[model samples]
Target: MLVGDHLGRVETEALLEMGRLDGALMYCMGAPESIYAGLALRQTLIGALRQEGHAFTETRFQAWFAGLTTLSDDPSHKARPPRAVCEAILTELTHSAWPVLARTAASLISALLAPHDLQSPDAAVELHTVNAHARAMVDALGAAALTPLPALDALHHAVAQSTVFAAVERAEPALKLVRADMRSDPHQAPRWAVEMLYGSCLQSAGALHHPIPLVGLIRPDTAGDMEPGEARIIRAATLCEIMSTQLAMLAHASRQSKRAGALDTRSTSRAPDVLALLSGFGAMRSAQIERVLKATRLGVRGMVQLLLTAGEIEQTTVSGAHLYAVRTHPSDRLGITAPLEEAFSDDAMDEYDASMAQIDRLLNNAASLQR
Candidate 1:
């Protein structure tokens, strides 16, 4: 099927008529953002049609709900990072400045959900309207260094409306099955798979108008790049990102789910496997990783950064060649690897000091020459 035009309103109505709301919602969930915007507007009209407190069974709503969530995985539409963004986040998440970052994130969310002055150059209020929760979220996020948070939060709030929430809540168990699959075999995930699956979960939560749930089962202490505690937090963020996609998909697929040949993918969640593969190989030639993951060189580099920051893996330069290795060793050992010093490793600390000293000498020499 073509990306956007493959589904339309007439087709969506037919799906609803035929009791294919799940599939329809699935298609909507996967549709493009531009299409989703129209769908959301239409949904606003539809919501006006039905009486307050009216509800339908899960099966009755799934197809229509799916249409809304189809593209919930895209980066511009949600706070959830694309694979590349994930790597960047992973790096910052572990940095000494994480507390600052976390506060920033909280501030953005709060700005979206509550009233606050944004630290913009113009000091523009985050949202134009006091009740424009979606726009507020966007404004708040736009003020921050990270750009995706606003649209993502908007998409999330959109999906949390009543009709969408019903469909996902009804199918909670099925969604949980998908979650279980990811935890059970993270190795099956391809490079972008985790983002996709997490998107699905987040959209489902939004459809239910519920706060994103914790992926407590996917603990890092058991097996993965992140530690148990970090994994939970990362997993939660990942879910938020993916749900943004699901929200978009719901609008896009609102029409396509009733049709037999629409809304198909290799799997619902493949992130775990992707992470596993990258982690297992430590560092391969950039080309090697690219070929295996079928991602761009830039994407692989981002992935490497994520692994590095999570302390799951590391890199070194030997004779002008950079190499990667999993940090299967203790954290104490890995601590020595950074530019920062580790008390136990005299060699790394000395090397780092020497490098800094050389830089200092070069700067002094340059200054003297200038004088």
Candidate 2:
């Protein structure tokens, strides 16, 4: 299991906060409700935790999980999840299968997130410590993880679309339909379609963030039924795009965990890394920045847009690809000057090379998934 220094120094209140973050991800990883659908649940857990932090433990986790069952689902009804559901969740967390699953996921996550250039004797143990937090929080989620919002029709329709971009463009509106289906089963959309839905779906703007490959994680239930036009909205290529983005953030969080403390995440959002990259590299296109830093395209675009608005970065076209660099004035405020080598250590350069190779391998694997 993901056993380690996870047992003590954790208060119930801290477990509540930690569990809310790790629990939702772990529960959805193996649940009928895919992790993508856990966005609201994730937000709910975050919103519900009004406590402070300390240590983590099984007893504390169980209490938090049970407490979620008491959270008011609506003004009239509290969400009393079933006892059987609760046990299933616990079993999934504590099961022998979890170590293997967590290791596989974390290894890839660590490789993608942490600097994979080298490993120390403590690397394996540190990895276990990373997953240990996730394991503890799994129980705090208990049975609130069962989300049966399936819409095979959406996937079918998605696959039938001509191009990936066409499918991506329309996914926003289609997912809105699937969420309503989640509430009342009113729409005839597929459940996998619901996985495409992220936070802030109903809002005028799309997800405050970019797309994740939740749609890529699970296959359509009727995949065999639509053999002819089953080309799929989530092609290996599209999955590669979404997965790249998710992997980038997961790596970002890994870096944060090291500095801020395990599960003590988001000292700041994803802005710093991008700003750091541009400040060091001088002028670079989005692709180059992503290659070096593992920041994905949509996210890079979002950050670039934000920086542009704040006048922190300026854009120029090189050949054809747009390049972004810290604005001259803002660079002064941030105390960043170009010339590259002064800004990045040799180890960091090695990390950049390793990350590029890793991304290339992942893209190659992505192509194989189409078969």
TM per candidate: 0.17, 0.26
Model 1 per-residue lDDT tens digits across residues 102-217 = 33222222111111212322212211121134223323433443312233333333333423111121223445546643533111111111211222232333322211111211
Query: Which one is best on TM-score?
Result: 2
- Candidate 2 colliding pairs, count: 15
lDDT of 1 at 239: 36
Instruction: Assess each prediction's global lDDT (C-alpha) against the native.
Output: 0.30, 0.33
**Candidate 1, lDDT over the whole model:** 0.30
Runs with alpha carbons beyond 4 Å of true place in candidate 2: 1-87, 96-216, 221-230, 233-238, 258-352, 358-371
Using lDDT as the measure, which candidate wins?
2
lDDT of 2: 0.33
